[model samples]
Target: MSPDTAPSAARVDPKLLRIAFILVLGTFMATVDATIVSVGIDTLAGEFGASVAEIQWVSTAYLLAVVAAVPASGWLADRFGGRRTWLAAVGVFLLGSALCALAWSATSLIVFRVVQGLGGGLLPATGQALLARIAGPDRTGRVISIVAVVPLLSPVLGPLVGGAILGTASWPWLFLVNLPIGLVAMLLARRHVPAVPPSERRTAFDLRGAALLSPGLAVLVFGLTEVSHGRTLPAAAGVSAGLAMLAGFAVHGLRTRRTPLVDPRLFAQPPFGAAALALLVLGASVFGTMFLLPLYFQTGRGLSAGEAGLLLAPQGLGAAAGSVLVNRTIDKVAPRALVVTGIVLILVGTVPFTQLGHRPTDALIASALVVRGVGMAMVSAPVMNIVYSRIEPAHLPRAAGALNLLNTVGGSIGTAALAVVLQNRLTARGPDIAQAFADTFWWVLGLCLLAAAGATRLPRTHVGKS
Candidate 1:
């Protein structure tokens, strides 16, 4: 049996499993693409004879485009059907990838990346919505738990994959690599991904809400990115404008007759409200640590990028194990219990990093990372299972959009905030760079606790109830 079918193949329909396999292929491609390019920025800059600042737009433009495009995904899936929308996204992504590979200059490459991001951004939330509608509530846990492994592994795998490509092939192959995976996914999707009819609710698209929300998210992420780079004035202007626009969208969502792009009201709903908050913080903690760890390994420990990536591999292994555990136990366990336990494990895992000043052994660091990875899988899968299971089928698309948006933005904010914290500590602590990382990890511990507190509001009982 394939790894994709593991833990509960007999319990899930074989067809659903096949659909999930295709969905994950696209998701893995998009998620990995986000980070894969980071390792190549220097190479890209050298090739184009551009400065680092100029080449950086290659990554930044893609991120902004993704943020702008995510809000529209729910409407697209509802207006046109999930399968069709998904296929279109894959097509667009493939086109962008090809364009990126053939780019004549840095400017062209950055623009092509934006085209890629538009499609890539829509993938995860839309795919989740489609899968949830097909699996229904009772089985969402098992299937989603299995599907969740892709993103969990992507952070560690991305840099490693990119490094390998750069070692063996030219940089264009980085983008070109997506073509084969995308084409296979598209072909499989058409054959196995059944077309669901569009929603009958006939409400017109919310252009005003889209105007406010999409640009608002994009600008906000840009601001946070600026914050990480220590550009104060631009960050301030972008963040303030983004927040103001988001507030306007919230007011618009509450008062509008037609549905808003992503309903702000969804965040106020019961277990969902709690789940959203948990995921928001979880995003921060997960992405924040991911941001910090590679730097820590390279600068503080003097490891090469490949060695840092290899050290990170244990976390992926742990998450894979945790995913299998969640697949088996999600139905049997209360969400609150699982999430709280997961947070505690995360706390345990992070403890070693906080003691980095002492220079812990490699074995200890690897073990802690494995524990952290397991904790992450545990927290994320259960939160998703609860939300997907409880929500009405019609709301899945928008809800998925909102949830993913929060997680994405939360990651940005967390990474930026931690970057600031790490920078401050590095300066204040002087040559004790390891100690500075240790201090920054305490903040990560605090984020885990915040998520744990949010988990307390989740359903205390099993999520199998109608």
Candidate 2:
């Protein structure tokens, strides 16, 4: 079970490829929805006659649901079988999308979005697990590389698509678009996904562990969101409560030792531990940049949301390019080297943003995004390949789920932290918020550098193996 020891390469099955593609489609819808509403906020506000504060719930509710539901994905998949659970998740997502499209008020939209988030949260974690299970070790990197395209494209595309739809159609068209995509995915998945027998399934649900973890995550996320909005005391309280709950969950998991919502013991392995830490730092830096860029485009440059999205396209394209390149060489490259290199690229990419002036041109920002995208692409697939390559096959599902959960938490923390920083700097510096953004970019640069430093600690190969 060494990193370099080749697992038996299963025959490439066209059916499995089709299933993976179908799963990617579902993931695309989910990830796209997470940000599509960004550009549509104004329209949604006008349509619902709601204030900005009220409309913010749409995003908050969806994110909370994502955090709440993500930890359960592995248990559900093991309990019900991946194929069945995945299909059901997609169904729920589509239903939520439809409901979102039909909603008449902000409240209804928020409610529907929670439903959407519940389904959406499962897609990434389970999709990765399913692909790993089906592809086996030899092809896992390549398969995940293909799947990586969804997240890479969806965020940049969200506002672009939303802008186009809003320009010609309506805001509702954002959610409406998911319908056809979801329906087609449902058909493809039903036709191609292999069904595992329920008799072979693990029956345990680990309800007690979930009860502890989910609420803790929810409270923490809510607090972080509040901090982003400039409410310090409530944010502090929420974070404190969340930490306490997390501690309690950890104790419970260790004391009981049966499968917990998250198996804390996975971190005992050096590779897994280092990779998770790297993922956390990388997630914070990467997602922090994502949140910052939109503000830079819209607020600093006075560009429209659509324009910002188009400018952001280079990052996504770069990521896609990186995924392809890294996947090709993943088996050959040292994971540590690739990760460190990726972090360096991220640092290089982010430096350009720190130099932006009041009237930074579209071309300038676009170039920076391209560089950032390239850095992201470099890091994503290799980190994944490294993690999966090192862990035991039987632990893939839970490991993947936990990795994904960490990613979510990291992104949330990054978003909230960066948001708070941006807000504070903007308020404190007054008209100098543009400079403030540059300062924040410096912090992002430092974070990337720290990630690189951490990545160096990853063994040249998985421990206990060649």
Candidate 3:
């Protein structure tokens, strides 16, 4: 069978399932590691005898490094082949984890996190490209739907798992826990992951574009974070510089005869454009809420980290249910229909959060989270399926890279923006933190509506059909 199309089988191929399972191991490790360490921030500060500000670099460094590395994933996969690139990425991540476990100080740990982020950033996009290529358009929706849940669920699970580990063992166990899962993934990948040949028309690496795009994205994320922290001057400088660099890259991408890092022109295509917009908004709504809820639980409700994590479990469960639903209906349903419906569900779930001033019951909150989780699963899988199915097999790498980059940036901005709003509201309405959170949730509702608007532009037919 040609790589572009495969015969639709009654059941998903067992071989494809094995490959996706292996790839998910790597992605889950990367995603989970990002959030897991968040739980240990105070513990890390005490362990290293550093101030909270300094200890924060451990997470910030990882984030900036991830942003910087994302754009190059497509090029690396094209140059090195997907299997080689993925294995190498997993190896690098494990190396970083080991180094982090051995670090003697906050500075050293932060530096090592950068190494891990570079590897971690590449896994999701590269893995998606590889799976899509193997599954072909016909099976892409089902294969991706099944595997996507791991990384999606990781953010919620990370804090819970991190709390458990820290409660039982010392902080080193936080990093060390990755060792077993990663080792198993690497071994399984070596044996089961098939090699994908590099693109035939390998253009020269776009060094100039890389300099502009990668740093632009990193600095932009840094700026947004600073804005969240209310660092006005530094945030302004960072945001300005980042925007200038990105503008430079966009102009260069249009003019350059050589294949730019990620073609600016790809977004002009109808399906790709709408799907990208939807993903961008979805990222903002989902991650912004993630940033908001934890603070709400800990500060407003006076719950412990473990308690908050436990309460958030319903969202993960809902996501699992949504994935099962999408996997079954994706082939029969239009992308626009699924995505729009998902947005509606998200809005319904989010409505309760906007009523925090009433002191909504824990049961009410958990039910809302379940609805929100299912909605998220619905949006992500369909948007991704649309992109993977519409693009040619060879373009998968860059396309995947662009989508991931947008989503990451969107999340960063959304979290930062919401943080700023929450801060302002708290300052304005002094003793009423509940009302502040309620005010902030209205913004999340706005994002979901915006996503719904974009979904209207998504392909109206079954994307899996050639």
Candidate 4:
């Protein structure tokens, strides 16, 4: 499977393309649902007669479910077939969406959201694995570049779609929108998604390892989420406990040797290990910035939620553009060079935000967002290509799942840590929300720098292209 010998383009059937598009649509649905709810939080709170803090759990619960279920994706795909698993996931997501829309109370909505998250979590990793398998050794980069757009631009699309639904209809429509799309995806998936025959290796389920890892991640993310609400000590304790459990899981994984939930051997490869670190930092920086941008607009600049969301769209647009460009050039440029360049652009983009005044215009924010988006576009596809290229095809599913797990956890940690930093600074500064946000932007800038340093460790080779 040398680069020179790989296929230039995937020999995908016309039917498979339709199926891939359906899968991508489902992926988009899940991602958009996660971010869209943020825009409707006020409405949801009023409707359910709940406090904003309680309503926040809708988002938190969804994220937690995603983290919990991500590691199981590879296993599920192997146990069932990819097509069967994907269809089941979409069906569950649709059902959850319907339940969420019809919820009589916040508590019920949270429960439904957990179901949604479980289903959504599988799309990213499983879909990647399917694409890799279908495309074979050749054309992995090209196919992945196309798939990358679904998640990359989802944040931008989510708010706009949510805002439109909120304005014309009710919040229920937000979930209802998934029904038609999910039905279409389910039908197409059954027809076109190829099934991988189950392995006859007879490995055990590693239930103990799963129990240790899943709850550990949950506690860790829970601790981080608590920081935004001014609960520092509890948050710190939760994170500590999570780390201890994760360490225990690692020991269990090593000792058992039959079949760990995650294969520890993957990290033994230098490129794979480096790529994982890059994902962690990149997740922290990227998602953390996303969490901060809206607050900066709403609190610092006095923009409404809708306005802030519209402004964020440019970042998504820019990222989409960058995904296309990077995917094309990844095979030509060294992975380290591409990663470092992307990170540097992201850092430079944050520079304008650090200099914001009390009343920044939409134009200024849009410009900066576009720059940040470009940086994102530059980084994401290349980083993914590098990670997958280093691994053997047989391990793609597991590796992709592990990578995605790190990504989700990284985002949770990054968002929570930045939230804590912003909260502490705001409390200390008092009535200077703008300054506090600016200070946090500076911190995000620093993280981007750190990510740049991490990028250097990636293998110095041209990725993707044959």
CA lDDT of each prediction against the hidden true structure: 0.88, 0.79, 0.89, 0.79
Q: What tens digits encode model 1's per-residue C-alpha lDDT throughout 1-466?
A: 3222224322777877898999988889888998899889999999999999899999889878877888888898889988799889999999999999999899999999999999999998889888888777777888899998887788889889998999999999999999999999999988887776677785689999998999998888888778878899999999999999999999999999887888877888888899999999988988789889999999998998888889899999999999999888888888888899999999999999999999999999999989988998998889998898888777888888888877877776788789989998998999999999999999999998898888999998875454
- The per-residue C-alpha lDDT of model 3 at residue 205 equals 99
Residues 1-466 of candidate 3: C-alpha lDDT, one tens digit per residue:
5444556652578988999999998889888887899889999999999999889889889988888888999999999998899999999999999999999999999999999999999988999899888888889999988887776687799899999999999999999999898899989988987788899988899999999999998888888789878899999999999999999999999999999998999999988888889888888898788778988999999999999999988989999999999999988888888999999999999999999989999999999999998998899999999999888888999999999888877777788789889999999879999999999999999999989988899888885444
What is candidate 4's lDDT per residue for 1-466, written digit by digit as tens?
Answer: 4222435564545654565676687778877887888889999999999999999999999998888888888787777756677778888889899999999999999999999999998888887776666665456655666677677677678778888899999889989999999898887777766666554455677799889898899988998788678787988898899899899998897888587888776776777777777777778877788888888878877888888888888888778777778767766678788778888878877887786645566687788888788887777667777777656665676788898888778788889999989988888779878888888888888878777777777878654443
Q: Residue pairs in steric clash, candidate 4?
A: none
Off by over 4 Å in 2: 1-7, 10-16, 197-203, 358-361, 462-465
Candidate 2 residues 1-466, lDDT tens each? 3212434563445655676788888788888888888888888888999998889889888888888888988887777767688888889998898999999889999999999999998988877777676666777766776676677676688778888888999777888888999889889777876654232446577878888898899899889888887787998999999888889999998888577878888776777777788887777887788889888878887888877787888988888788777767666777788778888878877877887655566777677777777777777777787777566565676788888888778877878888887887788778876888987887787778777877887868632357
Instruction: Supply the TM-score for candidate 4.
Output: 0.94
CA error at residue 280 for candidate 1, angstroms: 0.9
Local error of candidate 1 at 138, Å?
A: 1.5
Best by TM-score: 3
User: How many pairs of residues collide in each model?
Assistant: 0, 0, 0, 0
lDDT, candidate 2, equals 0.79
What TM-score goes with each of the models? 0.96, 0.94, 0.98, 0.94
